[model samples]
Target chain A: MSVLQIFRKTIMAVVCKPIAHFWFGLNLLHKERLPENGPAIIIANHNSHLDTFLLLTLFKTNLLHRLKPVAAADYFLKGGFSSWVSLRLIGILPVTRERKRGESDPLQACYRALERGDILIIFPEGSRGAPEEMSNFKTGIARIARQFPEVPVIPIYLQNAGRALPKGKRVPVPFVFTAIIGEALTYPGDRAEFMEQIRSAMAALKEEAPQLKWPEQES
Target chain B: MSFPFSLPSNTSLTAIVLIYGLLGLASLIYLFQKQRGGGSDELAARLGSWWVIITLMIVPLMLGALPFLLIMSFISFVALKEFLSITPGRMEDRPIVVAAYLTIPLQAFFIWLHAYGIFLILVPVYAFLVLAYLMTTYGKVERFLPSIGIFHWALMTTVYNLGYVSYIMFLPGGCNGTAGNAAIVLFLLIATQLNDVAQYVWGKSFGKRKILPSVSPNKTWEGFIGGWATTALFIAIVGPMMTPMQFPESLLFAALMPLVGFIGDVTMSAIKRDLGVKDTSSLIPGHGGALDRLDSLTFTAPLFFHLLVFTSYGPFAMSCS
Candidate 1:
């Protein structure tokens, strides 16, 4: 609601949309895989920054649920203009993913958002990986799902986001892409079994989508 | 029972300009509200400015019917081009199919000449038969027929839909005629757009059951009914003033408008899903693109136009009398 924020959003609504139209190609398929309401976790592989916008477009808002994305705090939550632009203007949530795993909780805020009956989008790979492969998922999403077993954990594949804005690249290259795919994994009560299910579900997501790379094993 | 009257002297033209300016203001306010927290695209702002300017120029020229029709025809041409560009047809058969793009201007011209007789037949019967014949004669039947046929049908709908709306505005009532006609157009535009907004609002507030989980997940039964009910109420209030119909009759028309408009919205949604696009293009701010704008028009225009025909031209008058 700040004046500068107001000014910036108007420009995007008018300016960036046309350019996005010419550059980025967004395809959403089998959107029926995600349920329409309540306590669902959307898990997708991370690739490019533009993945955020593409996901938002795929997450249509009618009257019920509005999709909120969990962005890395270090990158998008730097305060001032950038944070305002990313969080307030673009409707994304910023989480500190760079925090030490045991010492700090990266997904605490995300879990809080979920507990509050909000839709959460988590990039399980933890960081943006090359389009060729998905990295190992952080265990935090599983823990959150375990705590709230009733919630559906939806898996999504974001095709061609890496090409749009790859790691170490500032400029975006337009490659028409699809976002909505993969079925939601219903939670089983056991933790180890659930993690295995998640891993397998994540594998199947990458299997059918041969275009995307499987997650590299942790070093 | 007559609505308050007005003549198109300098005062009325000035009034028209002011009303248009207010509409520009309304669009801005709408953009601000939706995009307040979200970052705005510079492109959307620039295009929106252009849209406002065109709207300003367009409404005043509506002082006369013929000039108004010409201006509208030009808009339809631009709109149709945008539609074709987004929804690509056959690749190899581009040459012969491109001629169909000519139909936009041709239909406009026919409308200008007030040749309703030919205008009605030019697309559906004649154009369809001819386009089908051309595809078969060329013997590229396997590869090109379907795309060519789809392109022809799309063009036909685009022209027919837009022309129907323009035809309504051009009816021979003179400047004062515009006031009454504006009411009809306004009623349709308002009802449809409000339904879209209401569905979004209601869905956000209390949506649960998904209507079409695949095509549009956000569309809930509650939201749809809520939007329809609200739109019906708005239509009932405004309908009689715009048309010669009575209140109950107007209510009936208003009740039907949103259902048609919702269908138009979903039909376009299906197309966007096929094309894998978010918006048709970034033409309209807060709104989306030409197709996004025309989605409602597709249903609203033909339905309301025919409704006008039925009430004014058909046997309804005798029964009412």
Candidate 2:
């Protein structure tokens, strides 16, 4: 194996796996719904930066090389060690968060990755939001789903991840977070209705989160 | 007469054999129920859980103090993790949480080294001070007082409380005591678990009135009494084989242990009810989380240890006990 391949493999086994499973433990439901091979788009509610790593760790270890997390280009890819780490160590598919009319295609990389049978991980909520609270989702996920009708779109609702490592928090307090996976959906022909369907699915899944109220919530 | 792996005492060997023997009988019953076309999935799941807990406990427990301390430390880590995961804290208090977690290994190490004084006060004194200092710097002044109380309570319940049980294994004569260090631990384990089972069975069979309906609906006065009586009887019979306690001395523990265990169970139930969670997590089959399964220990282990310390062994041993 190449040196870079060995490095990534070691990092995944040693660092990535422990941080996801131990540091911020996941109580995964319907784990079998996560496929081994993919030409799939995995979408989840984004509340923390840790969401990307949590989802990435859920994939089959061997197929991990094929998993690509969709991230914003301007923010993550300033072209340095950060870019290298994001692209190689973390393996992100950079896309433009904002754009002008007829500008360079932000989603071109995602299209190519999907065509290569690589799984694309997207957060419908563009960025991290208030902990344990949901924000209005952008229609980017729907756009991706529309083009790949053959690929199954998986919805995962991660609970307490935001609280585990919320925005601006360096050290995470250990918390048992549940990852509730919803049934896979295929493109529903219309973009607007498809987004609505995904939102409804997320809402239903959120309700499924067992009435988890902490002592602080009570007070 | 001693088996291989240098088991601490013959009593530990007997305990291991008894555990497996019970497991074997349970399997037979499970098989018969399956043949009878009954859905005994919960029974089968419980058997598997018993296997996991037994292995996690017995293997390390028999090896010696170091391994036992290691396992106790691990349990502390998992219990702490389960606790922190459930209780929501401010992002600014992240440093305090990390500091809390870092104490698990140090506390475990102290017990292994028999630094009784330090082990007794590490979490209560040192860790608490460190967390307070961090919280002062990290505090946002929003919910500061309750937050301090949380960090201290979490450490005490998960870390300091269990230290007493682990410390028992390091007693000078513990390794060669009547049954061995493990016998004492095992006695505590079996007694606590039996009390739980006795209460459940009695409640189902004869319980009419609830004890604390809001905190724990299933717990009843009948169950509580039935469980205590059953456990006390078992302790009266088995305590002599495990510890230095005479039958009369064992009776005192029997009465107190079951009562304290009941307290622990309801206390945890209160936490779950407050948190609005059914169980901490489904980590252990047929039980709940590590916290759920060992909740009774949170109260019983320390109380049993202190009783043992003051009456049976240690610097404070009383002539009567």
> Across the candidates, what are chain A's individual TM-scores?
0.78, 0.92
lDDT of 1 by residue, A53-149 (tens): 6665554333023456877778877789988777766767777755675776666777777787777887878778765367778777777787788
Per-model C-alpha lDDT, please?
0.64, 0.82
> How do the residues B159-191 of candidate 1 rate in per-residue lDDT, one tens digit apiece?
777687666554544322345455444455556
Query: Model 1: how far is B318 from its true place, Å?
Result: 16
Best by DockQ: 2
Q: Score candidate 2 by lDDT.
A: 0.82
DockQ of each: 0.02, 0.47
Candidate 1: stretches off by over 4 Å: A1-219, B1-61, B174-180, B314-321
In terms of lDDT, the poorest run of 10 residues in model 2 chain A is A210-219
